[model samples]
Target: MKVLFLQPPMGGWVTWGKHIAINVNHAQLAANLREWYPNIDVHVLDCRALEIDENTMIKILKDIDPNLVYMGDALQTTGVAAIHPRYKRAADLIKSNLPNTKICVGGFFYGANAQNILEETESFDFIIAGETEATMPELAKELSKGDPNISVVKGLTYRDNGSVKMTDYRPLIKNLDELPLPAYDLFPMDKYVGFNYVKKYVETYHSRGCPNGCLFCVGWSNYDKRGKNDWTKYRIRSGKRVVDELEILVKKYGAKFVCIMDEDFNVYRPRVEEFIDEMNKRNLNVPFFFMGRAPYHLRDKDLLKPLREIGFVCGLIGLEAVDEETLKKLHKNVQVDQVAEVVNLFRENNIMSVTTWMVGYPDDDESKIKNRFERIDAIDPDMMALQIMTPLPGIPMYDELKPFIQEWNLEKWDFQHAVINTKHLSREDLGRLAAWANREFYSKPGRIQRILYDKNYHPLCKLIARCYVETADKHAQAAMKNEVFV
Candidate 1:
């Protein structure tokens, strides 16, 4: 049996210029398939990182001629997550070019719309509806036999006699540690580059599933069938295992920085503490970043300083909004003051923090928009990512906003682009305001000086700060000229 995993090409996130993070999903799945089914030939084609053209992808498919092609959705919750809708076209092209090869897809987007994908695309023979590690191998083994019974395979959707049918739901993995380390050696690791924040940034998945039930998030929706809060059930690898992989990445792969791509890194303090202690003991110091909620940072205040000692110099902090009312509407459960406190903490500890702001709420008007940015300016985060609010499917707000969504084209769902206008703002106006907010936050000469000259910030962080301003200025200019997005 032969299988090829692909990370399809992406229309780059509009907020930043062309850059590709490592497709950790592809690497991890390839590792699992290789480790469990040793006799089966496995390969990966990372079109996103390599920027492989369609011609090259088709040629590689023809050359390898694998029996099955697999891809992942990167666990997106919104239309924005459905990157490069070209995947449908690519799959169609592959089927026409190679009639016998089958395609399978699984991830956040696919899992959410399994029946639709299976029904819509002739190229997609199967959709792995849950975590693919355990389920994929079982399905592959069944496929090896003639006329496999897919009904036995849990968390799958497939065509049955010209109709889409789904199998029983699969349970989320109880222990994430059971999964193998991603096969980074198989990837073009050298080609991977981080965002402006870190150049040679390697992504790590120490945990899976978020514990927080943010109403706008699709985290809970993915596992909705499994029962409520199933999706929010947090699972993580041992800290030793996490740092052990980091040591390998640093020593073998020349990783300058590591991105802990957990939904919530600090959900459990003990795991974080263990990882920190392991890093200290091994002296496996390399710049690292992770995403954390505001409250957790407050809870783990003491340990954060030592984390800095281990090269934990930066991370994304979710200051999703400036006002308490907006935070409540989003079900962020984070206080506006807590948001301010955490931003201050990161600053005090020399940790460059990236925060987010979403415009276009129901109550959003010119005055509200102005006040939001004013509060943000007062808070003064190291970086602020501004986006027009997009209510993705499965979120509570999706049903409410669906009728008002002006851009039904899924590809434009990228957060940077406004898909829906608020009751108070037009889509174009939302885009303009978002642009204005970016300019407002980063345009000051004093702010620019602090960003570049802050002795507390790492040199790479300084570079990121400068790059952010330039990008925002470019977007602001485009927005001012009435462009929906830069």
Candidate 2:
């Protein structure tokens, strides 16, 4: 049997040159499938990497002549950011061209609602829910056996006649070390390019599941399934296991830096300390980056200092909104004051910091939007990314505001689009506000001066800043016409 995994091209609104939009470790999924059926030939088709057109993709599919096709349903290119419309369009095209091949869909979309997704698309023969490390192989074995009934397969959703059936949910993997290393060797690792902040870096995950129950987060929904308060529901690999992978990447693959792509790298304080201690003891001096919550580092200033001393260069922290009410609505536990204090701490320790904020929340009015921008200006970090609030599928905000959604087009769900109706502003009004905010923030003389004087300034930062300025100007021009509004 032959199998092919496809990652479709991104839509025009979300395209970013030649880089893949989401940077998931799909090698892990492919590697797990290979382990289950070693005799079966496996291949990956990164549509973004090849920049394939419809005709090219159809020809490739015909040439591979796969018996089974597995495509990621996750849309985001580098992170679990948002759904890309191209994936949906590609799935439709694949179903039409490869009617004989059994198609399977997995990733964030199916993980959230496998049965609904399978029914809605009517494209996938099976949907793998949750972690695919164990379920994927089991599914392959059953398919190879010519099993007609798929409902019996645990952790999968499949069509049964006209109805959709779902098996029992699978438990999260506890012993991550037992799994094989991702088959990075199988894909074009050399072709992968990191963004400016991670130019010399490769990405890896140390754990699964987040303890934080931020209401606007889909991750929080997954963690809440355990039904525990403050459900620190994370499962991590041992420091030895982590270091072992690092060693392979450094020595064998020529990886000079790593990006710990966890939701919060320092969630488990004691474990992180142990991991950092081990890294220092072994003299593994590779520079790295990670994301963290402001409150976590503020409570342990000493802990952050050590991480900085041991080669941690920067951290990306999500400061969703500056106002207390907006923060509460988004279920971000940290206060605006805490964000300011943490920014100062990181600055004092010589660690670069990048903060993120969201505009266009459902409850936001013009006054609220201005207030949020004011907060951002006051607590300005080394760098910042401002985006419109998008209620992604499966998030609490999505369900709660479904009736109020002004736009149902999947492509508009990108953070750049204003999809939901605001209490105080029209979609066009929000677009104008976003353009004005970007222009005011980046074009400010004080902000420009700070960027020039910053010791850690890099070429990538300049590129990103330039992109922001260009995007802002483009939006400003469109806003004047009032015809480009979503």
Candidate 3:
């Protein structure tokens, strides 16, 4: 049987960056399917990398004429997380164009509501939930057998008569080392670009599931289903295994920098330290970045400094809300004082930091919101992102704010839109505040001066710093006319 894995066209936000990257997980899924059914012809169409449009996609599907279609909605070449709406459109078009083809959907969106997704997109015949490495192979074997009882398939959801049938969720993968390295070669490697902050980068996941139960985050709730393991529960691959993949990218694919895309890069302190040790011992000079919590950084200040010296450029710090009360509401374990200390630690080590802040949280009042903004101005990082609080489905924030949720469109959930009506701030007010934060933080000349004065500034640091100022100026000018806030 022939199978085609389709990654739909991503929105402009993902395309805005110079280099468009492929979803590592999608490549892994393709590789897993090939490993399972070696006889089955497998083809991958990454729309973002190839820059394929509706007509191009239609022609490709028609030409392949596969028996089954596996569409990935997790991460498009676009940087955004949620499945693009175009996936549904592509599935619908394929179903109409090729009646013999069976369509299936998987990835984060489907994981959230597998049954509804399959039903809503009438084109899809089945839905696979969680860790496609194992599930996809099992699903294929069952389908190949012409099994009519798909409901019996574990981690599957499908339509039965008028109702949706969902099987039990699969357990998380324990031995990540057992899995094959992601099929990066299957993608157009040259098309992928690192963000402005780094010269060249490849994204790799160290583990699945995060223990941090930050309310505004969907990742937190995602792991909550796995019983007592804290929402931040993490299972990491061996350092040798991680380094093995990096070596392949470096030796064959020419990856100079790696962006460790874990929810928190330092989840297991010993493992992280070991990983850093392995990289150093092997003389792996590849620079890397990661997502880290302020508290973690503070605790591991000594350990992190060495990593920085060994090409760890910068990372994203989740300073969700500047005010303590707002942070408490968001379930972010760190305090405001901790944020200041973390920033100082990064500065002391000469590592650049990109801090993320959320405004207009559900429990926030005008005073609290103002205080948050003031804190943002006071504790400004080298780079910052200010977004309105969005209550995504399956998260505690969503449950708490569902009554006040004014919109449900997936596209609008992109931090730019105010989907929920806050008690203290109106939608318009939130938009303005976001615009104000962008202008205030980026508009100041002193922001650049601080980076320049820092003792540990590298040559590449100057290049990234210039890019930040230019991007900020562009945003400020654009937002001034109330044209670019959304």
lDDT of each: 0.75, 0.65, 0.67
Candidate 2: clashing residue pairs, number: 7
Model 1, span 1-486: residue lDDT tens: 888887666544545443466767778888888888887788888876788888888899899998888877443311244453656777887898998988887765566667766787778899877677777777776776688898898888888898899888788788878888988888888877655445676778877777776766655434524445565678889888899899999999989978787878888889889999999899888988888988999999997799888988887777667777767877787887777888889988899988877776766787889888898788778888776666666556667777778877666566776667778888878878888888778876698788689887877777767668767865554445533321
Q: In TM-score terms, which candidate is top?
A: 1
lDDT of 3 at 319: 84
Give candidate 3's root-mean-square deviation (CA, Å).
Answer: 3.2
Which segments of candidate 2 are over 4 A away from where they belong?
A: 11-18, 21-25, 73-84, 196-201, 220-232, 456-486
Q: What is the per-residue lDDT of model 2 for residues 1-486, given as tens digits with 9 covering 90 to 100? A: 777877766532221222332234467767777876787788888766557778798789889988777766322333233342455576678879888888876665456656666777776788776665666666666677654556666778777777888777776678777777777666555555444223334678767766665666545322213233222467777766777767666666776556676777777677778777877777776766777888888877888778876667667788888878768877788888888888888778766666778777777788888888888888877666666666666566767766557766655555665666687788778878877776777776677555545666433444444444445554454434432211
Higher-lDDT candidate of 2 and 3? 3
Instruction: Let me know the TM-score candidate 3 reaches against the reference structure.
Output: 0.89
Cα displacement (angstroms), candidate 1, residue 371, comes to 1.6
Steric clash pairs (candidate 3): 19-193, 210-231, 210-232, 211-231, 211-232, 211-233, 212-232
Off by over 4 Å in 3: 12-19, 73-82, 196-200, 220-231, 449-455, 458-486
Please give, for residues 1-486, the per-residue lDDT of candidate 3 as tens digits: 777778776553311234355676677777777776777677888786688987888799889887778875333223233353666777878878898888777665455556656667777877776555667656765667654557666777776786777777777667878877887777777666654544445778767766676777755433313334434456667877888888887778888667777777776678778878888887887777778888888878788678887777777788887667767866788887887777777777888877878876766666776677788677767877666676655566667778777756566555655566788776666656666777778767878876766667655555556555555543333323433211
lDDT of 3 at 295: 83
Worst 10 residues of 1 by lDDT: 75-84
